[model samples]
Target chain A: MNDVRSINCTQCGAPLELHGGHRTRSLNCAYCGAVMDSHEGYKVVEQFHDTLRPHCPLHIGMQGVLKDVEFTIIGLIQYQTEEGDTWIDLQLYSPTHGYHWLSDEQGHFIFSRRVRDIPKPAHISNFKLKAPVFLGKQRFYLYEQYRAKVQYVEGELTWIAKQGNWLNITEATAPPVCLSYENSVSEEDYYKGHDAHTEKEYYYGEYFFPNDIYQRFSVEKSAQDKPEGIHMAQPYQPGLTAAMGQVGGYFFWVGLLALFVILFMNADEQPRLKYHFNQTELSTPTLIPFKVEDPQKLLEFRISVDRLTNHWVAYEMVVQKEEENVLIVEKEIEFYEGRDSDGYWSEGSREARALFKLPAAGEYSLSVLFDGGSQSTPPPLFVELYEGVVVVRYFLLLMALSLLFYMWKWFHRRSHENRRWEPVTEDEDD
Target chain B: MSTSPYPAYNCAACGGPLTLKFRYTKIITCPHCGAGLFLEDKAVKMRGLESVMADYPSLFSLYENYAYKTQKLTPIGQVRFEYAHGFWDEWWTLMSSGEACWMSVDEGDIAIEQLVTLDKMPFMPDLQVDVEIELLGESLRVTERGSAQCIALKGEIPEVIMIGDNFDYVHLSGAKGRLVTLEVQNGNLFAYEGQWIDPFEVKRL
Candidate 1:
């Protein structure tokens, strides 16, 4: 009995035992009752069973099981007796197998081997009711007669077909029907669904056969292969507008943003001293009087305000020179906002127009007053220099364009020379 | 999504169709009414309502509540000299809960920020302000509620008065204790001297 016994329901932990009569045998568990079989041993069932079956607790989805099992649901058979007890029959796939009055509930599909989840097919002839339909979590169906064409494009197998007109079919007619296969089905069974069309295309991902349908019409899939000036996709399409649009807008906006950033950075970047030192003063060891290359350019100032009173109090600037013995010719601070007339303040109103040129090219000191204690709050002030930055920028731009033009000329000349170089070809060797 | 099926009124003066500007508070008036015949609640009220609401919509909406109970305002203080003032019973919406409630307001220490029915107004300080809303026979309190404050001004900011990210408005006083309003407008927060500078003007500036 122990040798004849198989483990009971492994999932819910039920014991199974032998049932039926002496003529016909069945496996039934007594402790946690689950009736499994009537036949004594294993038997061959059906074809579709090879691809899909009931899930087994002992074995996982794709693993092999001990028995050959197949079954089909045909119809629901019912009966009623004089005692008023109800009975039913399930028209199964095989004729020899018969099950009787078990319970009031409908019967379930059972397979000896575990069922597997199938992979999705690349193409399908029909969009609706397509496989693999999940009968249960594990059980699935590949369905019946449908057609698809599988061709190798690039490294992947993609399905494609010639337009129906090429097949001599009606203008409105579609191609032959195809079946979508569950992954458990063999590749040969998958190809059987592919109709024999010589003009049909085969694709594996993006790559396709040289004579494929897409290739035959000269369709270019990538942006690098696209020719200049033609119909294009929306700005969002991958190769058509996406690439060029991004490059166009990206460079434009990026250039604009970069310009603003550069201006802001330049504005914020403040022409800081890469290195500041009194070279002549250090060399000669003087207490003061150092020469500066451009005394007009050195304007390093910091503004401080009283936090409590919210007042602009003072501003301090440090100036350096390149040579000694330069006298302080004249120097005065000036301020303005919007334009010169909106509000203007200088060291002295009368001498405001006088140019404060350095006498002998040496370091000098300058300071300014935040308020002369006037009732009218002078508009926000920034130290203004007579020299405009536009001249320097224009000069730099001209210098850069000239350099780029010459560099481009040199690059083209070198490339042309290199291509023109010939190591005697076989025809030329003669 | 609930739709009001009631037929709207037409301006009696101009013969133009009148639409409800506020939810239940109906001050039906024609735009061509030439700024006269102000409708507070259901009654024809005053003349300067157009200018009053220009500076404060929340205040005008709340003031209309008094019209509901006594049918008008009781003449009080300075208002008694110019026009009649009264208090009435009406529902004021608590912006935080989106529910209509009864509240009250008085003549003294009237905080405009506290009286607002909705927090959608663009103002300054941006802190949750205590509102004074006048309701029917009683006053209800809705606290820590108001829209995000956004103000604008012109002139100068001496210290590192950062805007956005953390603070909304910084009240700074310049020379002579002159109050200057500074707020984030467009992107830059400018410093302006007078309260007379309109919010829209500051935005444009």
Candidate 2:
């Protein structure tokens, strides 16, 4: 289908190459500023004496592969908004995919195509900022509205595009994807028997990075434009650091699961030994012996006194592991109860416990001596030893470290999204 | 040069030799004189003179065999219609399996369609853009509604086609490239159920 046909410019007699298909309506001469009607045997429809060529990287007849489809650049239209901001749109045509547009503004590129599925509400005039618009199953928010006038026209177009023709464009974005509604009122409808109606069209666009366009079209490195600021439709690209953050998120869940497993496995409620000492033997030290099975797990030693109301008991104990002093501590267990105006209240505990890990799985002895109490005579003291307790503080520290990675990724994504909507927020504030 | 297996005839208007590529062909235009001829009870009769279609680079040509994916299609006749914005060509094609279908070409957009009969007729006046309708168990949305006139005709056609006849048409689109086109002409409605075909996949044989 790439049968290259050439024709001389109707006005300047300069040679021109035709690359567009049968649907091409008009051709604007690049060498001589004359617009010819392509349908009517290349008749000169209008002419612009002095038109300055716009700066664009892509030229007519240049072929490139976009989305696995090979398309040729057939036309170029430069448009300027009322604020004097200008952008270039290159018309692309493929034998199978029909026509598409590649737009360049502020060094950012977007590939767009006319879509037949109409957006909800259909008209741009009914659009409100941040309002939801549905196109098929996808939902988009109204982003921006602007009027752009044609500043320069070159090559062949499907419609008779001339200089100064304007279009009112309303854009709605769902990030990386944008839906635009374009409305134009043309004086020349060009049909034989139809009333002139305002032309309304919808286009679906996807944001393309500068490098992607340059690589696809084989554009020179020097011709690549540096992208400035953030585009409204640009999706955030995660870097290596953010990827590590995702790994951290997985580690956090794994660490939590490990903590729960340790807790469940170490939940041993049976004590190794329970011993009691009478008041007569309280003056002398009593030795209680227990056997340790797992040295990696913690051992708990509990001392308690019975029937010691509004009084306290003092005890001195030493834990020995096979003649080696593993631990030595002095602890007091006190209980105080009184009837107040509000209700019965209690203070302190009747028991105290100390935890320690043994060096080896062998015999461990707890020697306890009851010192004194408020009753002048000390109550009977009971000593209990329990093995296989879990240390929960260590697991908490590990989980906190793993969570930092997930938080890092979350912050980066949030920052990128915030910047994308900054302009919309500013407009709302105004 | 009539090596085709189908029946052949002579043009009643210009005495030019004509060939039928399909069995159900009722109208065949003389390639020499561009005359629209009707086949009635094994007799050829002059219907009208078809206008010469302008030469354009198209994916298919009259009586040309093409391969669309795994299916081989041979275009037997073509009818061009002028709509509000532009014109599209409907090529009546016969498949390798001996089944006949219509391939509609508008610029680069192409669709392979087959005529279907509906149990109930739809009210054309009630149809509007974006309206949902069910046909042949599939739901479709009306995408476009307009009127078109038959400006050119050529080769063999299954039904009567008159030049300068205007017909109201509606295009409905469904999921996964499904399309249904409805045409109303002279108080008669015709339905075509089809799927959109990629032009690049169609290769000339």
TM-score of chain B of each: 0.23, 0.92
DockQ score of the complex predicted as candidate 1:
0.00
**Candidate 2, Cα interface RMSD:** 5.1
Which residue segments of model 1 deviate by more than 4 Å? Answer: A1-300, A306-308, A312-364, A370-430, B1-205
Worst 10 residues of 1 chain B by lDDT: B75-84
Best by lDDT: 2
- Each model's iRMS: 44.3, 5.1
Question: Model 2 scores what on Cα lDDT?
Answer: 0.81
Model 2: per-residue Cα lDDT at residue A366: 75
Residue-level lDDT of model 2, residues B1-205, one tens digit each, is: 8876767788897787776677778888777887778998779998855577777657788878899878999998889999766788999999998788999988678889998998987888778998888877988888889999998888888988888989999988886568898999998899999988756567888
Q: Spell out the clash pairs found in candidate 2.
A: none
What digit string (tens of lDDT, one per residue) describes model 2 on residues A1-430?
A: 4657889999899898888776788888988888999878889897755678987777788888887777888899888887788999998887556778999878888999877666887876665788999888899999888777777888888877766666778999888999998876432432232322455778889999989888888889888788877787888888888888888888889888888787777665778998887876677766678889888887888888777789887877888876777888788888999998999999999988888777889887777767665667778888888787666677778668668878989999999888887876886788
Question: Model 2: runs farther than 4 Å from truth?
Answer: A1-5, A48-50, A186-197, A253-287, A294-394, B1-101, B111-205
Cα error, residue B71 of model 1, in Å, equals 99
Model 2 chain B: ten consecutive residues of lowest lDDT: B48-57
Residue range with the least summed lDDT across 10 consecutive positions in model 1 chain A? A150-159
Highest DockQ against the true fold, candidate: 2
